[model samples]
Each structure stands twice: as structure tokens, then as C-alpha cells.
Target: MSRRSEEKLAERADLMVEEEALRDLAAGGSGLVGLDGPGAGTAAKSAKAKSGGGRGGKEKDPARPRQPYVPARGWPGAGGGRVGYMDPPTMWRATTVQACGMWPFAAGSGSPMTGVPLGQHLFTGATVCGDPLNWFTRARYISNPSLFMLGMPGLGKSTLVNRMLIGLAATGVVPLVLGDLKPDYADTVRALGGQVISIGRGRGGINVLDPGAMGEAAARIGGDAGEVLKAEAHGRVLNMVAALITIVRGRPMDDHEQSVLSAVLHHLRERTPPGRAVLLPDVLRVLTEGPDRVRAVTLDRGSDTRYRDAVDPLHRSLLGILDGPLGDTFASETSTRIDANAPAVCIDISGIGEADTQLTAAAMLAAWSDGLGAVAASHALADAGLAPRRWFFTVLDELWRPLRAASGIVDRIDALTRLNRSLGLGDAKITHTLKDAEALGTDADRAKARGFVERAGMVVCAGLPKTEMEDLGKVVGLSRREIDLVSSWSSPPGWGVRGEDDEPPGRGRFLIKVGGRPGIPIKVAITDAERELHNTNTRWTTNEAAVERAAARIAREVARPAQEGPPPALAGGPAALALPGDPGFPAVEASAGGWTA
Candidate 1:
């Protein structure tokens, strides 16, 4: 035997020993590969017999075969049938402070649960609540309690604001829609049992000289607070007069002109009887009379001619507000005073034509002055403990009109935005787009207007053109995804089918951006009760007869057989379907079984 022959014989003996060990294990012996002791094999077999394969323990049948492995077809793709090697990802919720330690790299803890519950988070499917005032005073998430909302027309800008108004009203926050251009909030205000003060030609009116709720508040809150309220009320009237002059003259009043006007207003207020509101006509009368106080401010030097010349321009403008295109809207006593204690108040200026930009601007300025004065008075009374503490939600819709109407209006709104927090006011500024600010006359006005967005606690944006995203990004720090999402919402509507109205792609979608954090995209969902109140397009919408026809057409379509094909064309061309209102389409009527043409 050579060396190679001895090696082959040794390998054969080792393989035989391994095969015997495997056989013993299959017969229920210990699984240790090389262990072949009689005691080990007997112990393993006894354990296997005790632990039977059946539900109840029973002796194992040696003749029974093991169950065969069956393959499963799961989701399509490689490894689809394989069992998961690891558990699926899970979500654990915690407060922001706890989340910092748990997920240091996490983007956010989703939208805050505080504030007004607007709608669901577009991405996370979580309920998103937001309100600038609530966030500022309650959650303390933002420094300022003001919001800026911008979007395109017909995209539910007014609807979203109405939602916040309704929510805040429920939370005991009064909603004051200072200037409702399209009367968008009138119905909602009425439904909320609020005051809807209309101001337009042949409609209602607003007396610019009236102190509104401030007078009552001042009397109720006597002492230093009362004096402060009176002073603030006086200042508001002065500012409103100045703003109106600026609008009419297409230029702001000079220092001397403002002084003369202020002096005239003061004289008029002094002579007015208690509980009697001042009117614009009274101010004009005082200026005409050349009172000593007015003359001193104008530096007439005791010359009647000098006094008249000094106030000639101011007189003409005030006269224009009374008798010009503005008509009796501002000259007469206010038709309906704003009820500060009401759930909401909407100054509907939509009765004014859209072409009358200047008049609209003046009306807006006056409404804002009156509304804010009421807010200030409310705060003063609450502080004095003479009235219940109340929070006001101010809606400044069609913001561009006022900014463009008068440059002075910008300064007024700027001051309001700054002092909103201290005054217990949550301001919401709504406009078509950011470009509206850029369209202002002067660079200073444009910059100040843009600050409205910058200083806001949060910016809620709706369907806007791609062109708007560039300018909006500068103020809101929008990410590419957010920009794309917002721009996508501006897509045009698709063709209507089955007698349904064609809705805009981004009708109720909004992106709420706060600071540099990721945006919260929300789709506003209105309740059934709000459906009729939220319709801002009543002018362009179909009449009742057309609506009934549409309803019948829809009923016919629903009852029609699914297998029914398109109607035949007039000629031997491709079959064409007749639209609901098409002339050739047949009228639908109800039958015993269903609707029929």
C-alpha cells in the first residue's frame, strides 16, 4: 500500500462515521453531529415523543411523512414571497421637547394641534390647526399674531379666511372683516348672527367722523384708560381723514395740511354734543367757518382769505368724498354701527363697482380705521375690567386696493401689524399675489407692503402662478417642492362632464409656511352649512332654472345604462355626446323606474 492509497481509505472511514451520526439525528437522537452515545439517542427520542406534532400531545407515527414546504405568491417583484427579515417602520409621537431627544434629525413633529383646526395635513394626513392669535397667545409658537394669505382669484381665498373666522368665533374671538370687497363674508357674518354693514351707492353708509365703538368704550372705561381711548380715537379720525385726502388728491397731505385738518377735527369734536356722532359735513362746515383753532394751525395770520386759500385743497377733497363717485357712503351717518360684542362683523364694500378703485380704497381705509378703533376700545375696556376680555380677528381682504389707493394707507397698516400682539388682535391680510405689493407706486410703499408678509406669523398661500413663486419665495423661504406644489395648484380647470361644474384644480388647497420650517399643505374642507355661504361667484353662477336643468341632466346620466354608448352625430361622422345644456340634447323626465330622456 502506497501513501495515496492510505489517504483514500482514511477519508472513506470518516465519511461512514458522519453518515451514521446524521442517521441517528433524523431518528430523533441528539443533533450534536458527532455524538452517537446510546443514552443521548434514547433521551432525544423520548423528548420528541412527548412533544408530538398534533395539537394535543400523542405518540408520533413513524409512518407519517413531514409536511411539504409550500411557496407563496405575494406582491409582484423579486423577494415578494420571502418573509420580512425586519419589522416595518413605526411612528412615535411626542411633544417638541421630547422629539428633540428622540429624533434629533427629524424634520418636525407635524402640524401643531393648537389654534384653529383648519383641515388635514396634505402629506401627513394629520389634523392641522392654525391661527396666528391662538398660536401667539396660547401655543406661543409664533412671535406675532398676524397672517398673510395670497393666492389667485376663484381659489377659495375668502373661503379659507371664512373658515378661520368661524373657528375663531367659536373660540370667543370676534371676527371683524374690515373690507369685504366681493361681499365674500356677508353671508357667513349673517349666519354667525353678526353685523353686516353694507357701504356702497344706494346701499348703507359709514360716517368717517363717527368714533364708532370707541365713544362708548371711552365712557365705560373712565380714568387714564378712558383718556387714552379718547386720544387714540381722535388720532384714528385724523389718520382716516388724511388717508381719504391722499386717495382723492393722488398725493399725501403735507405736514401743515395735516395739522390744519387735525385742528379742524378737534374743534368739531369739542363743539359736538355728547352721545352725538360727528359727520364729515360737520368737519367741512368747521373748516368753512374758519374757527380760531383751525386758523391758528393753518397760520392764517388773522386773514380770512389766507385761511380759505390754506384749506382750499383740503376742502375740495373732503367735498369730493361727500359728493363725488363715493356718494353718500362716507358722508352720512353710519347706517349700522359695528356691534363689537357680536360673533362677527363684515363691512361689505362689494356693492361698489370694481372699476371704482379710488372709492374702494377710501371705503377700505375707513372700514379699517373704524374696525381697528373698535378693537382698541374693546381691549381698553377689557383692561379696565369694565367689559369682558375679547380677542379680535381682523380680516383685511383685497389688501392691494388700499395699498395702491393711497401711500399713507401703507404706514397705517404697517403700524397695525406691529401693534397687533399687544392690542389682542390677530390680523389676516389677503391679496391676489405678492406682486400686488410690488405694484405699489413708490419703492418705500412696496417695501412696507412686502413687510406685511415678512412680519406675519405665518403665510397661507393658495393656487398661484409660477411667476408668483419667485417673489413669494423671497419672503417665505419656500423650498423647491413647496414651490412646485403651489404652482401646480394654479393649473387650469379640466373640461366638465356629467353636468357637474368644472372646479379649479387648487380650489381649496393651501400651503401654510411658518419661518424656515417645511410647509404644511392643507386642503380646506367646508361643512354643508357653509356651502351656500361660501359662494362668492353668485354673479357668474347659473340661475335657478339652469341649476334645475343641470340637476335633471345629472339624474338622467346616473339612471342611464352603463353600456349605453355616445349619441349619434348629425352626419355620418364619429358619435358625439350632447352636453347637458346643448340645444340638441333632449330634456330629462322622471319615470316609474328612473329618469329618462
Candidate 2:
């Protein structure tokens, strides 16, 4: 072509070729410039399907009609809908103990299996058990074989005590519930063929001057140690009596008065025969009479007057104990003996009330002293290898009330705690809180009381108030986490709720702090019969049938005048009275259902 005409012709020719290629691509010919690759036709089909169009050739397929895109709506801003991936801010650092504490599944090693099986651990399914005496003698996991339990009422504190005592009893370890507020131990005592000494008006009494405890004290400490322990035992009894005076007098004992009381107890101990139980009346006799040789001993008449002054207050104090509400319970000889080998020897002090603090304190002290003696006797047997190394568990139930009631109560408790070690005894102090210990008289008294908490080899705590939990931590060396754990235990998830939600700490649930081990949550369980026997929820329910029967019998007797004629000779034996489902009468269980139409 000529210059300009040739170029125009060339451009027209190029346009024609491009137009042909576009027409072919529109017809899915796959012959376009970039569409000529090996997988070019497959890619074309994918694009055609995505655009809602029909494909071409063997791979041809009908594309589904596309729906218009609609965005989800919510609170405005980019925060709506599925969120975008965001980077983590930072990694937190924590120690293993701290880390594990945050997570319940993570727990430290369990307590050594040195004692009786108590219960299953709350976190792990491992078995948790503890016996202070066992831990003490082994010298492995614990320092002392004393236990302190803190929990609210109805949290199974006393019930757990009963279980421990009975469990030990089965192992040939004698058990003694020294002071019982709920008094549930009585039935257990009776069931185990043990005696239950109930101290109340017209009930069995304890001879405070009984030599059994002293004798055991002497045996537990042989030779010079025994002499020292014997003297301690003597002093304990004297102090115990003095505390009783202080409780009754509503104040602490004067120095001179205390001396006079001690001298009187000493004289009574010397004069009383070993075979006879030294009664409170005997001590009372000494206090009032002031000894026959007292006049000769005094160098001056003023000395006699001073002696009189000391003796008068003590004598008056003695009179209150011997003639007050406790008179019937303590003035006479003990009706029951301390059988060291018995399964249990419970002193039912439930009859003694808060108003009768003096009586309760005196009764508890007496029972505790007597229990120590029994434990001592058992130890002697165990030492000779005559017995299977028997030990005793001495339980101090509702320890706080009596602790607050008397001035010398802490001293008596301290003595018991000390003497128990040598006497083959494990002391368990059952109370609500550590504050009870701190509530003693002076700072020194409070410190002494606190010693009980510290000396305890194991601490079993249940749900406690936040304040009480903190107080417990401070007094007994509980960690911050432990205090939080205990306080949280105050109420479990959905506690006291109905249905499956009712996850309250029903019974025997406690946080056990043993030696240096981490806190272990435990749930103590027993058989149905054991539950019935150990049910100490006095305020909730009781032996309704027995109570009703008693009331009915009393009513009948009151209504029907007695014209005394052999007093209606028994038609049937004692069995007839208690027999369930008799011919004419329904059983207690049936009667418990209430009057039937």
C-alpha cells in the first residue's frame, strides 16, 4: 500500500482480527489469546459458573442463579457479625501453685495414707484419711496428734467426730466424747456397749477427785516424768475445780483463794481411799472445815485471820458448785467407770446449758481428766505388748461455750493437750471458729487457747463466714488461697436449692489442712445405720416416736391415779414396748407417719 493508505489498511486489518477473537471468546471457543493454556477451558467454565451463565463443550454445565448478597445487621460499627482475627495481647505469668489454685483440677500431692480412711478428696477421686495419733507416732507428716475442727452448726462437725471416734474404736482405739452438746454420742456409746455418763439433775455425777486420771497420768509418765505428770494431774484437777469456782463466781479466782482451794484438793486427795471415788462433797468438806491442824501451823492469830479470809471465798465457791444446778451431777460419786478398752465412754454434758456454764465447764473438765486416765491405762497395756498398741480419741465437742464460761478453762485444755500425747490420746477440739479461742480472758489466756489450734496436727474446716475464714487463716497459718477456698465453701454452687441444683455441703464435707500438705476437700460418708446413730442435728429433727411415747405415758400416768396394786405387773418383756409392727400397735416407724384415718 502507498504510505498513509497502506497504514490505514494495516490498522483496519488488525481491528478485524481482534473483533473475530472477541466473537470466538463470547461463543466459548477457548481460542482467545490468554485462554489457550492446558487448563484454560476449566478456568473458563469456573468463571462462567460464578457469573450465573451456561458453560460450553464436554465440561458444560448449567450455573445456579445467584442470589443478591445481603449483609447481616446488628448494633452498628465494624464489631458487628463474625469478628476479624485479632492478635493476643500478652502471656500471663504465674507459679505452679498459684496456677494450679486457679484451676480446681490442678492439686498438690495428697496426704500420706498413714491413718484411717476418712473420705474421698473433693477435687481428685483419691481417698483421704487422717489420724493424728498415727501421724504423731510415725513422726512423718505431722508434729502433734491434736485436731481442731471449725464449722457452722449443721455442717456435720459433731457427726464427723462421732465417725472418727467410732472408726478408731473399731481399730481397738478407745474413744471418749468428753463434752457432748448435741448428745448424739450416747446412742453410739450404747450401741458400742460403752457407757454414757449424763450429767444433769438426777443424772450420773463425776467425782472430780477421782484418782483414775491421776493414776493414768503417773503411768503415762514413768519414773520422774510420772512424778511430774502426777503433780501436773493433781494441779490440773485443782485448777479445774478452781475454774469451776471462777465460772460460778462470775470472775477470776484470787491468788490466796486459789492457794486455799489447791491445798483443800490436795488434802482430800491424800485422805480419800484409792478404792473409793473422791466426791465433790469430800472436797467441799475440806474447804469448809479448813483442816484441824491449821491453828497450830499459824504462828500468829493474824495468820489465822488471813487463812480464814482465803478459805471463806473458796468455801463459798465450793458451796455454789456443790449446791447449785450442778450439785446433783458432781456432788456424788461417778455412776460409771472408765473402761479403757471400751469402744466409747461418752460424757453427755448436753444437759448442761449455756446458763449453766459453770456446770458444763466442771463436767467437761472432769470427763476430760477421767478420759486421760483411761487413755493412760491403755497406753500401759500397749507398752507391755499385752494389747495391740491401743490409743484413745478424746473429743471435746462444742468447746467454745465452755471455753468462754470459765477463767481456767484454757489452762485445763492446755494440760489435757499436753498430757494426751503421753497418754496415747488424740485430742479433737470441735468448735465454730478460731475466734472462740481468741475470745478467752486476757492476752495470755487467748494465746494459750490459740495454742490448741496451732498444736493440732490436722485442721478440718467446713463452710465459714468470710471474716471467720480470715481470722482462722491468721490464727492457724492458713494461706490466702486456703482462706478463700474455705470461705467459698461457706456455700457451694446452688447450695440448698431443690432438684439436682441442691448441691449444698450436705454432710461431712470439709477442707482438711494436714501438716504441710495443701488443703484437701473431703466428703465423709457413712452407712445408713451409722447416719441414724450419728445424726446430731438436734435443732432440726429428733426421735419423735420415742418423745411422743414418753409424753403419752406420762400423760396417762398423770391422769390415772395410782391405787398401788403391784404396779400392773409386766404382761410382756421390754421387747414388747419397742417391738416394731406388733399385733395391736404400729411400729415407731409407722407411728412416725402420723395418725391414720
Candidate 3:
């Protein structure tokens, strides 16, 4: 046959198959392919008869008894060609971006098999996996190794991180939990045979100013050896003290107060023994009588008085830290040291309950600083060609409290966030909300706080309420489709039969946005063994019930005293009264007959 005739025959064959399918469908048949039976053929013939057609009867010329009313069996038998369908040429109108997005499957676009295995991609069944450290190290990938995870509580945020950390640990990446407020990671850490440092008053201590770590940190940064080491030690101590004092005073440090703190740390660095830690008591004593007193000769009378004034308030603030709930947590030397090469370490701050945000922030700072120093030391030793590995991960769970403690504390956090690359640290900050940025004291602090999230290499965000999507989109640069998918991943408004035993959609599901790349929705898939070890889901359990009851009882106890009488004045003790007329530190008093004096 001619080529044109061959094409015409193929088209006829495809038409015949489609006609047979239509007939079967119209006759209340499934139209399923590859079926052969008497009932199917009868159904096809009956439908063709209803349509007033009988095996192309008009072309048959009334030949051979009209083929005994037999239906077409298959496409090749129905027509004359060997194969069934020959589809016509077709094209879809779409932009390059849209077309590229739709090739094969939407989720199959640009997902590489790198880093640790996360889970299956939402749209496509392809595996989606990436680590912040791996992405940061790759050329032109992510700029920073910091990451943020935001989700509602009990929606697998903690559980997901637990899985990721475990995966990273398996790959020789050490996971250090900077602050575990809920104390949920202890089981995972223990299961991995890692260390858990319980940080609280008297339960354990984390000396924020451990000279040994500070000295090692100095050695790592590569400076004029001992002097560089001492200067580094002084700076670390200064940062810790300034942040602590700011938290204690509920404000930023003034110039003279900052100057006094610097001087005191400098003096302590010079006077302390080689291996002694810089305790808060040492800082308090130096603040009271060291620099301002020694520098008295250089200052004129008014300046001297101002110096004395700043010194006393600074002294009281430092004194409060030495005497407050955090004193035992950070005053002495660290009882348990986080090894630089340990597979995992979890600093449990659950001992400091919700009532003490300040204590929680302080302990976090101490532990994080210590961990940073250790990691830096490891990196330095690697530089010196002595260490086995040079990377570590710092997981900051419940990160908001420390970020919102004070502006100075935010500065410290920014420093750590910026140094993530050089020190080989991948900081994964976990939080329930992003409002912690707005809770900062100043616009600058808020911007810095948000900038930390902005600079992250990846953000694993789960479901958020409708109201929060707009702001979250702005903060994280989520696309419209991404926001829609987030809503899809959220639980439906009402329930149905299929959903009765269905797990909440938001749990274990997350939108993973690699820096400036299309966000891939993924879930944290774990083995049964992993599920038991890293489970943080306390909801619908007896433990949850007990926690609720205890919280209620504590609330009642706290409210009963307030109901009985007015609050006592200066319950903050001398720290509230020792600001030396600084208006920033206001002192209130109760007067008789319900009047202010």
C-alpha cells in the first residue's frame, strides 16, 4: 500500500477501537481494556444495535448473513490494521516555566538525591532529601547552613527534627541540642547512646565562661597565640555577661555599664588562674569595686560619680544572676562537657518551666556558647590536622525564648547565626511561631531576628492557620501554590467516615523550601524503631492529662495568693531598688487606702 494509504488505515483502526469502547460504555459496561467473554460481546452488540449500526452494515452489501450479529472482538479484528490507536499530533500552550513545571510530574522537577533522606515528595513519589550542611557546602546552592522549622505544636515538628538528627547522626554528623525546653529528645539521645545535659538550678551547671573552652576557641581563631586567646576569652565572657545583665535588667546595657563590664572581664581575665572558670560571683565582685574604683584617678569628680553609679547598678544586676534561679545553672563549672566528636548531645532545659523564661534563655546561652566553643575547637583541630571531623549541628529547640530575652541576646544569636559557616555548625532553630521576632525590643533587633530566618538554607514549615499564611509567606517567600498546598496539607474543617481513623494530615507533613528553589512538600518517614525512640506526641495520652491537671493546679496556686492580697513591693529584691535613680528601672510601691504615695 502507498504511505498515505497506510496512514489512512491506521487512523481507521484507531476510530474503530474508540467506537467499540463507546458502544461498550453506553451499554452499561466498564469499557475495560483486554476483556474477552460472551457477556461483553453481547453488551457491545446490543449497544451497537441501539445506535442503529450493525458491523458497518451499509458497507457490507448485505453479504454473508450479516455476520450472525457478532460483536467486534478487538481493535485489529474490528478494523483492518494490526494495532489499535494512532494518536494525532497535539501540543499544549504553556509558558516555559509552566511547561518545565509540568514535565512528567510537577514534583519531579529539580529534586536531587543529595543530603539525608527526608521523605517522599508530596506530588510525586520521588524521594526528597537534603541537609543544610550539604546544601551550604555545594557550589551556588545555599549561602548559609542555618535552618528554621515552624509548625503548630503536636504536629510533628519535634518528631521530624528528631528523625533528621538521627539520620544525620548515622552519617557522622554530630547533633547537639542547644536547648530542649520540652525535654523530649532525651529518649532519642539515650537510644543513640548520646549524652543528655540536664540544665537547671542544682540539677546541673553550665559555666558560661569556661576558660578552657574559651582558650581553645582563641587558639582556633588563629591570632597572636596567647594574647589572642586571652582577648577571645575576654570577648566571650563580655558577650555572655552583657547578655545576662540585659536580661536581668530587662533592658539594654548603657555605655558606661558596658564599659564597666568590659573592664571587669578584662581584669578577671588577667587575675584568674590558668584553668579557672569565670563565675558570676567573680563578675559581680569586679563590677562592685574593681574598674570604676581603679579608674577613679583618670576621671573628674562628676564622671567619677557617674562611674560609681553605673558600677553599683551593674553590680546589683550581676548579683541578681548569682542569686536568681539561674545561678546554680550557670555559676559553677560545667558538670558535663559536650565532646566535640560525640554523635549526639541534648541539653535538657525542661527543668526550667515556663514561669522562668529568663532562666531558660540564660541556660540556653550558656549551653549554646559551650557547644559553639567545642565545635570551634574541633574545627580548629581539623585545621591543625589533628581532629577526625570538622562539622557539628546545633539544634535550638524552643528557640524563641532566648531570641526574645533582650536585644543584646538577639545580637549574640545573630553572631552565632553569622558564624555558622566558618565554625562548621548547622543551626536548626525550631519554634512554634515567628512572632518571636516582633517580640524583640527594637526595630533593629526585630530585623536581625527575622534576618536569621531569612538567611537559612532551608525552612521546613508544616501547616499554619489561614490567618498566619500571609505573614509567613512574606517572611519565608512562599509562593501562592505553596500556600495553597500548605492549606491542603492542613486538616479539613469537618470530619467524615474515612477520616475517623485517619491521622491528621499536618502531622509529619511539611513544605521544605530550599533556598530560592521550588518548595517541595515532604513528610518525615521513620522506621518503627525510630518512631518509638523519637516520639514526642503527648496528645490524647495519660501523661498529657496529668500535665494539664498539674498546670491547672499550679495556675490556681499562683492565682490564690493574688486573690488574697496585693502583690508585695520590691519582691524583685534589691536589684529592683538598686538602679540608682535610672528611670529605665522603675520601682513601684503600694500605699494605704488604695492610693499611690
Candidate 4:
């Protein structure tokens, strides 16, 4: 019963089992059939096989039987196989305060879903809704209720503003497109059932002397508020007249002359009949006549010569406005005034050619005066409890034109930008580049003009040149990636096949930058209706069709014999002329006789 003797007996037992299993294998029998031992099951055999039978057959365990073959199964969802339905992941909304606590590990942020839905975010594909007033009043995202939009020409600056106009109008905010140089918003205003007041030569008139809605609003209220409004109306007229004179004279008026003009306007208003609008002619006539009020204000004591000499410049400037190129537009009585009840209104000044810088400048100033006067009147009535409170969305497009036209205009726009929030007005200022402000005449004017962009609640930019981005960066903070993204959009379009319309890379792409926060890049999406309503290329397309038609007509005329009789050179026979679109007719040149092949 010693330990060595017991081990020898166990070895002898293992040898006997091995001989039986090997003999059974040699007889072509199943080694695993009816196996009865400690390691005689399939699992024990599989484990031994996986261990390689103790590195060699000599050391193989006989008690464990061999395992049977079994094929491997494939994954059900692989190789385009059917898979069981999976429960979709759920998403829950939370405020920022709640989100910070609930999802403490999440990173990054997105534009808030507040204000007008302008377009989709460029990175996260989230819808971006933003504007100055909406973001300020609703979301408390920005402090200023004004927006400045800068972009290259033909880069959807006006289209973006039009989108805001359409959206804000739906929210019961009246839109006022003051001095639409390209008439970009006229269609939008009309589509919104708003009034489109055209001001140009032979189109319509806006007498700067006419108080517009302010006068009417002042007349309706009879308390101290009414007197305050009346005084405001007079100041508006005086300032308008002064602005016009500055535009015509190419310089700001002196205090003495301004006082004389102010006094004359007061006297004219007092003498004029109620319900009648004061015209520029009335202003000029009153200045020409040396009335007591005019003399008193001029400080000319019973000296008609000194009085006439003093008021001579003011008299000539008013007369110039009455008889100048803009006479038909600004000198006459008001033809059409903005309708406050309408959802939107635009002063269409596109009829005036852009080349006439002074006229454009004067008309734009007058339109601003008139538009803001109407807004002031609305507030007055609301304060008096006679009308419901109203909010206005004011758009100032081609802002540089007015600024460059008159240095004084900068002050007026500066005042408006500062007071927009208090006046219940949300305004957008649009221009080609920041240099437009920098190109102003005076240092003071340029400084004030630059403030327009600086004080904007938000800056919405489309494709802009790298140089412009540099200038813009000085006013607003922009990162390298944002700069590159914006500059890339300004790249020239690739050449396209004939008859294929090539769209600019940044046609509707915009970057909304508020303060130093991460920028929200968006690609404005326009509907078919909006595309039609906001088409700024109508002039180009129409001109192309017109040119094609003209070419065809010229070709027909040249191809046909002259009814009156051909010139002496072609009298012998009708000239052969290849019509447009004919084979080999790449172009036609006109000779003295007619269009040649």
C-alpha cells in the first residue's frame, strides 16, 4: 500500500484502456460509443484535441475519446442576410441648463432654433433660424436689433434680406425697404400685398417738405404728445431740406442759413392751409420773400440787402432742387406715401440710374426721411392708444451709395442704427464690402459708417474677397477656418457647357457671425415661388432674350430685299446675308449697306 505501488497500478489501468481504444479504432468502430470513464465524454475529447493531445501522440490520454466534425455557422446579419428588427434609438430635447446636467459628456453646440428659419447649418445639417430683432427679443442672443450684411456682387445679399422680409412679414412685423436701388424687394413687397412706391423721374414724387405720415399723426393727437409730434415733424422737414441742400451744394449748410431756412419752413407751415401738403416750391418761395420771421431768424435788422444776401445761398439751393434733374421727383407734392397697415412697403428708386450719384443720394435720403417719419408716426399713434403697437423691419440696401453721396448722410444712418431698438424697428444694412464704408470722404464719416457693421446684432456674410475678409475681421472676430470657408465661396465658377447655367459656388451660402461665438454657416434654400419672386437676374435674362430677338430681326431684315429699295451698291440684286443660327454663321458684322455674312 505504499505511494509508488499505487501510482504503478494507476498507470497499468491507463495502458489497458489505451489498448482497447486503439483496437476499436483499428476495427473501424466509434471510439466515443458507450465510452464510460472519467474523461470519456465528447467535451473531454474536444478539450484534449484543442490542447493538441499533450504535444505528441505518445503522451495522448486514452480515457478521452475523439470528437466528431461539426461545421461553423455564419453570422445572421452578415453577407446581406436578413436580420431581426432593431428598436430605433430615441432622442429627447432639453434646455441648455438641463442638457449640461443630463449629458455632461457631450461636446460642441448648435444654432438655437429661434427666430426666422433662414436655412440649414453647413456642418451639422441643422436648420438655422436667425435675425436681429428675433434673436434679441425672443432668444436674447444679441443685444443690438440691427444686422449688417456684406457680400460680393451677385452673391445673394438681397436674396437673404428678402428671405428675412418674407419671414418677418409672416410674423406680423411690417417690412420697409427704404431706397431699394435695384428694386430687389419690390416683388417681395407686392407678393406680401404691400405697397410699392416708385420714386424717380416720371415715376412718382416724394416732397421732402411733406411731413408724410408724421404730419397726419401729429394732427390726430391734441395733447402735449401731439405738440411733441408736431415739433418732431417740423424737425424732420427741416433736416430733410438741409440734407437736400447739402447734397446739391456738395457741403453742409452753416447755422445762420439753416436757421433762416428753419424759420421760413415754420412760417410757411403756419400760413399754409390745413390738409394741404407743403411742397419744395412753397419752401423756395418763402425763402425768396424776406418775411419778418425770416429776417428775425437771420438777425438782419431792417436791412433787406443783408437779409437777401444772407439767404441767397439757401434760396439758390432750394431753387436748384426745384429745377434740377431731381425736380420732377422731389419738388412735386407727395404722389404716394407708405401704407402703415400694409404688411410691407418698398420705396423703389431703381428707376434712377446709378450713374447719377447726386440724384440717387438725394432720393435715398428723402426715402429714409419719409420711411422713418412714417415709423415715428406709427409709434406716436400707438403711444396715444389710438392704434395697436406695431413692429417694423427696415432694410437699407446699397448703403454705400448714400454714404458716399453725402457725408451728412452718414450721421442720419448712424442715428437710425443707434435708435432702431428703441423705435421698435429692426433694420438690415447691405453693401458689397466693408471698404465701401472705408471709402467715405471724411474720417468722421468713415468712422461712423464703420460703426454700422460693428454695432450690428449679427453680421451675415456671403462670398467675399479675401481682402474684404481682412477688413471685416477688424470689425468682427473670424477664425482662420471661417475665413477660408468664406473666401472659398468667392472663387470664380467653373466653365460649363453651352446652354448650361453655371451657378456661383457661394450663390446662397452665408455665414452668420454674432460676437465671438462660433459662426453658423448656412446655405440658403429658396423655394420655387421664392426663386421666382426673388429673382435678381431678371434683367440679365431678359436682356439676353431681347438681344437674341434683335439679332433675329436684324438677320431677317438683311436676308430680305429692301421694300423701299436697296442702297446703290446692292441695287443690282438683293444682298446675300447669313441669318443668325444658320450653318457657319458664327457672327454677323454690319457694313454700311446692311448686316454682312
Superior by TM-score: candidate 2 or candidate 3: 3
Name the candidate that leads on lDDT.
4
Candidate 1 regions with alpha-carbon error over 4 angstroms = 1-109, 494-502, 545-597
Compare the candidates by TM-score and give the number of the best one. Answer: 4
lDDT of 4 at 408: 66
- TM-score (all chains, Cα) for each model: 0.71, 0.64, 0.67, 0.74
Q: List ranges where model 3 is wrong by over 4 Å.
A: 1-110, 216-223, 284-293, 296-310, 475-477, 492-501, 543-597
Supply every candidate's count of residue pairs whose N, Cα or C atoms clash at under 3 angstroms.
0, 1, 0, 0
Taking the tens digit of each residue's C-alpha lDDT, what string does model 1 give over 155-203? 9888888888898988888998888887788898899999888888888
Q: What is the Å distance of residue 469 in model 4 from its true position?
A: 2.0
Worst 10 residues of 4 by lDDT: 69-78
Per residue, candidate 4 scores C-alpha lDDT tens digits across 535-592 of: 8877666577778999999988987776657656543233335455766445656778
Name the runs in model 2 displaced over 4 angstroms. Answer: 1-111, 213-237, 251-274, 277-292, 296-310, 377-389, 475-481, 492-507, 542-597
For residues 481-536, what per-residue lDDT tens digits would candidate 3 score against the true structure?
88877766566435666755556778778888866678888866667887777656
lDDT of each: 0.81, 0.69, 0.71, 0.82
- Model 3 scores a C-alpha lDDT of 0.71
Worst 10 residues of 2 by lDDT: 67-76
- Model 2 global lDDT (CA atoms, 0 to 1): 0.69
